[model samples]
Target: MVNRSQNVYIIAEAGVNHNGSLDLAKKLIDVAAEAGADAVKFQTFKADNLVRKNASKAEYQTRTTDASESQYAMIKKLELDEEDHQILIQHCDHRGIQFLSTPFDFDSVDLLVHKFNVKQLKISSGEITNAPLLLKAARSSKPIILSTGMSTLGEVEQALAVLAFGYTEPDSMPSIEAFHFAYCSVEGQQALRQNVVLLHCTTEYPAPFEDVNLRAMDTLATAFGLPVGFSDHTSGIAVPIAAVARGAVVIEKHFTLDRNLPGPDHKASLEPDELKDMVRSIRQVEAALGSPLKTPAPSELKNISVARKSLVAARTIREGEIFTTENLTVKRPGDGISPMYYWEWLGKTAEKNYEADEKVRR
Candidate 1:
């Protein structure tokens, strides 16, 4: 399991950018490892199981891919067989990064768990209402990262219920009664909490910044009390970086070997150098977030005396002279009495003579 409390789990989503070539897929893994991403994710699904032969492409897919081709045809060409999965997993192990793939169907889910032995499962936005897939993933006993896009709070609740109760019906609505029954026991709730993480996403390619609605991540966190993250589809790295600052525990962004590649997701995906910059920036942000307690930092401790004010003698004073506002004022080099004690020292007598511009002693 990923340590959500520390660094954000960064996923370089290399979704179908390989264009059916195992060599290209390995290259994507290499890019993700070199870029310092925690994992490289791909999509796992048989084209026949994923889409109908006559199903249309999404608007963004139509713009990026061949308009005349059916969605099924477009997806069929990108399918990676069983041997391809093994090769990629070996490559990921050699490259020193976790291998992850979003399973689009029940068979794909089984393949990921039984064959690849994935530690966690990532569900795409389109599967938010996929009840059978949800139950299957939950039954696998691996943690899940679920993306919510083009979905309402109620739909998300239904999906969670499916995971919790092992629901078999795909179209049934989730209710409070169902939730209560599923979690009536302590172990059930604990199991649910341990097995789930939610992700907020905008289901568009190169999603508009206005549509990103990053605040929804916090909403999901508050609502579910589970770790929340962002599946960013925006054109730049700024949004994901900001998501980290806003308490995102994970960040999933699409990436490609080259943006000019002919594929549905290539245009919106980050190139290699940009991926590195995003990881670097996220680490910098994590370092800068630091502790919640407001105290003097080690680096700033030395500057306190140089920058803060202290009560000092405004003019020369002889021994036993009465300290007054005219003889004492605030100045820098706070090695003596702090100016906060000014009023307390105002009518007192000086223990000894003091030169002008000298810090006053207690």
Candidate 2:
């Protein structure tokens, strides 16, 4: 969804940290806007449509939330209705930040793209295999950010094939072969290039550092030949900043009004100040990743003569005198002949007289 001219897009993922409170959600919007995030993202889904009532909570979820509550029950409480979406969007508009949400089910996808008109759609890592949902998202024609986590390259490719099919939707019946055909077709590839951005992610809350595999971002770029970014779940701002350095075009990280707030994602999320630090650090890294050419930067050009060496007289010498090893040396103030000609200048007649520590001329 980002143009080539734009800096790395940073998304402050407020997620379910609002804990079913509209005031808290609006406050999160304010925090993200104040932090200078490109967008503030929330999770939008009816828990009934997403998970079975008896579905178990994930280990990380259980640790952060009440283990006694079923996954559906916990998420059911976090569900943001249509009115909630409108309120959050208006809040985001007032705060001057884009509003985004991850759609976990078919209706949620429709709600985000059709009703609310979000600029882009973010497909969760868990939905990478949910072909129906992926197809529905792709069919909407909105740009999609697909997260690859707890999955293999092959799985990511398969998900992409489904998306490709949805985007190019040939007249044939939907099937694995049709999806493969679409993936192999020129039209499907072109559609993907224009509308999809892949995100490298690790599917764990507070994911381990070793498991991050930031290099996988490169692999995703190479293998898929699409714009790639990162969905960070690690403990701090460092990894995401490093990801930007490594050429991630977008960075999405979870944030909360307060870490100690009783919610599933709060503990793994950055607090307000930490979120600000993260956005500032990411912008700094983006600026540092300036040009690919290996040459002196504009700021360092003036320092070259002062810092580099040039041929100079080691001791006093008369005009037309023979330049010798003992009389010639390399020194600073490189406006004179470069030290590379030290051997050539040796034993040659000096064009002009020079004094001790003076720059030698041809």
Candidate 3:
């Protein structure tokens, strides 16, 4: 497994939960930093370019947002312009947390790259099929974490191909020869690909536990030979923390200042304390996994005498008499002949008189 020194990258995706208010957006950043998240993420996009004017809302999109509103109209209200991006980034800096925003289209990718100075990039599930968008982001040379929700295996392969072929620079992965450097999504089906991580996710908002198929995340790691993580849409901290125990290297969960906030995602998001608890639980689990060796620990050997057994005389025995099963047995205080020697000692002549319950010496 690739030992990623960057502790679990806990990204609190505050996507559109600000309800189109810049003040609320800054408040979300404060909550993320206070919750100890490594990054606070937003969505950067131009509504007109993001969706067709007539595109319908996703079943999830229709629930918290106005069903009568076209997807374009709904998204327009949530749009964050260049000024908003700059202010959010500066707010993140002031709060001492990294700011990240997923760009939904080609132009937004350019804006995030040339204008926002993002250290890492996130590709939303919807864009997993957007090869041109993936290519634009890949050329920027920033590391990318791509979400694969509602995508088929074949589509992911095509997008990954664009990233791999478009970049002229050599990859930092040990498998790649040393040369130049460029950015790529690192999204292939290769098991154990050190640079890539697969996130187990259910596309449903407030995803049902049964559909999570968390075991598939393990299957992905085993089948692809890469690190695996979880992108949780479940309503609480439990599922994400459980994913960490199951070997997730990264955990991306939605966070908003209040779950009651009016937005498509707020109802499924974690409040500040829950986000903190999730991160802390994940770190605690990482510590608990420890070394796999099974030998007695330094703290366990001292109890051996009190916990194990030794061979002892069960009844009084005369000198020169034969040792019999009735006269010998195993008991605690393990400094004498082990009980494993029972058959060998059976029927042997006794060297001396022995008292009842005394440890027997060979």
> Each prediction's Cα RMSD?
2.7, 1.3, 5.2
lDDT of 2 by residue, 1-362 (tens): 46646999998999899999999999999999999999999999988899998999999999999999999889989999999999999999899999989999888988998898899998889999999898889888888999999989999999999989999994456899999999999999999999999999999999999999999999999999999999999998999999999999989999998889998999999999999999999998898998899999999999999998999899999988899988999988888899888898888998777899998765
Error of 2 at 276 (Å): 0.8
lDDT of each: 0.89, 0.92, 0.77
RMSD (CA, Å), candidate 1 to true, equals 2.7
TM-score, per-candidate, Cα-based: 0.94, 0.97, 0.82
Over all chains combined, what TM-score does candidate 2 have? 0.97
Give stretches of model 1 more than 4 Å off: 167-180, 183-185
For candidate 3, give the lDDT: 0.77
| Candidate 1 residue lDDT tens string, 1-362 | 56766789999999899999999999999999999999999899999899999999999999999999999999999998889999999999999999999999988999999988999999999998877787788878788999999989878877787777652332445555655567445555577687788889999999999999999988888887789989999998999999999998899999998999999999999999999999999999988999999999999999998998999899998889999989999998888788889999988988998999987886
lDDT of 3 by residue, 240-261 (tens): 8888778788889998888887
Sort by lDDT, best first.
Answer: 2, 1, 3
